[model samples]
Target: MPFTDHERAYLDAQHIGRLATTGPRGPQTRPVGFKLNTDGTVDIGGIRLSSTRKYRNIRERPDTEVSFIVDDLEPDGPGAIAPGWGRGVEIRGRAETLTDTDPPLAPGAFSREVIRIHPRRIISWNLDPAAPELRGRTA
Candidate 1:
């Protein structure tokens, strides 16, 4: 699997993530909504997805690499401070623009077009309570 059980669980629980991609101008990063596919790939979709720069970046250069991350601060104690513990998963991979796929990733909120990321590397931190450090490896 591209992700460990803990990493998968963390990703599955999160709704928002950030995607970074390079375009003619430069690199661009934006907040996005994603879904975890059964094959362990990530499917990013949004309103007017195909017209977005991120989607155009992939469509322009099919091999364009992308980075995606999902993270949050979790309370460390019953009354933890405002800044809590940090945990997240980062995925780096090549992305492709998929248009008119079967059932849309998110029906009402997103379009049928989506950016699918095939992970080549994965980095995770604090997902496993037993190990609270950054861990990375090629997928």
Candidate 2:
């Protein structure tokens, strides 16, 4: 599915997103710097990426269902969860880790190793010009 302008804006505004993957021990999650590719897939990179738990989880279970989320306080205050006060996105998709180096999408992320995500189900809240509510598609 294609991402809306608001969704893309919020995603681009944030630098780090939480990645969740299930492995042998159960579900695991970690925060990592990411970049949005031109094809709509999410690219992840970090130091010692291949050795990280999130990377290992994806390698161990390529079929693992992954969920990525990026959200934050509205602004000057911490009360960013009152009613329709949240701004961010949740992406449910399949993920995999690779070692092939791709063209640089951003700085500070590992170039040799990366986690790529193909979003199937996605949702966004409180980010719209006309209607700032829930928006997205589910598979």
Candidate 3:
């Protein structure tokens, strides 16, 4: 299922996301900061010019997957709550590198190109174990 407007907004509110790709060495995972657009596309930055492997892989194979956790889950501390409640979203999409102009990055940052993701499918789940009523809601 695809994400709804509300679910898309929830995903956009998140600051960090995980990107998964297949390289010559096999599965690769990296943390990234992303911007979600209203048109169901995602902009990902923080790639270095020298990071050719990831870019090459994505170029050769546009199919890719991304995941983001939307809930605020801080590990429980001595006085913190034991179980945290939140939701997570996963998207499968075709990735393409945007080359019209240099991506907006901080000065001296590694990545200058933005990878645009066009989502094909989206799945979401609430991580709270006690919240069975909220299960299986597609966003």
Candidate 4:
């Protein structure tokens, strides 16, 4: 609910994100295909999702904080005046394994479990454009 219109639009345009999870050794980050749910949660679907280290860490520590990031990158051209830095949104949230789905997302996968991220905070830089619906909102 806290996502501004531009932020929402930016997220809606992206398909992949990095999910950072706490591990026994330290922190582990993995690229995950995520679906932005209508209820404002990110659904991370993958084969053997329940057996992933990210899932295991979250299961072991329900209060674990996970950071999800989706960015738009462009390479600086040969004569570009300014360096091109990444533009994207960073979302920090809590994660949980969801297995209520009947069919597995991947072919011949064992479980239909998905990681759901509940966004607690979102930070973005040059990642959103001024939108009509976001006229009075802050990015």
Highest lDDT against the true fold, candidate: 1
Candidate 3 global CA lDDT score: 0.60
Say which prediction, candidate 3 or candidate 4, comes out ahead on TM-score.
4
Model 4 C-alpha lDDT per residue in residues 1-139, reported as the tens digit of each score: 7676666877887877899999899999998877777777777877778889988888888898899898766346663222376667788888887776633235355357788889887777654434211122221
TM-score of each: 0.90, 0.84, 0.67, 0.77
> Best by TM-score, which number?
1
Candidate 2 lDDT over 24-58, as tens digits, reads 88988898888877788898888778888889899
Question: How well does candidate 3 match the true structure in TM-score terms?
Answer: 0.67
Sort by TM-score, best first: 1, 2, 4, 3
Each model's lDDT comes to 0.86, 0.79, 0.60, 0.73
**Candidate 1, superposed: residue stretches over 4 Å from native:** 77-83, 102-105
Q: List candidate 3 segments past 4 Å from native.
A: 47-52, 63-83, 102-111, 127-139
TM-score of 2: 0.84
* Deviation of model 2 at 63, angstroms: 1.1
What's the distance in Å from true for residue 90, model 2? 0.5
Give the per-residue lDDT digits (tens) of candidate 3, residues 18-102. 7777777887767767777767677777757325565666876665544333445535555333346445667766778765435
Worst lDDT 10-window in candidate 1: 74-83
* TM-score head-to-head 1 vs 4, winner: 1
What tens-digit string does per-residue lDDT give for candidate 1 at 57-113?
989988778999998997666533234777899999999888886423568767888
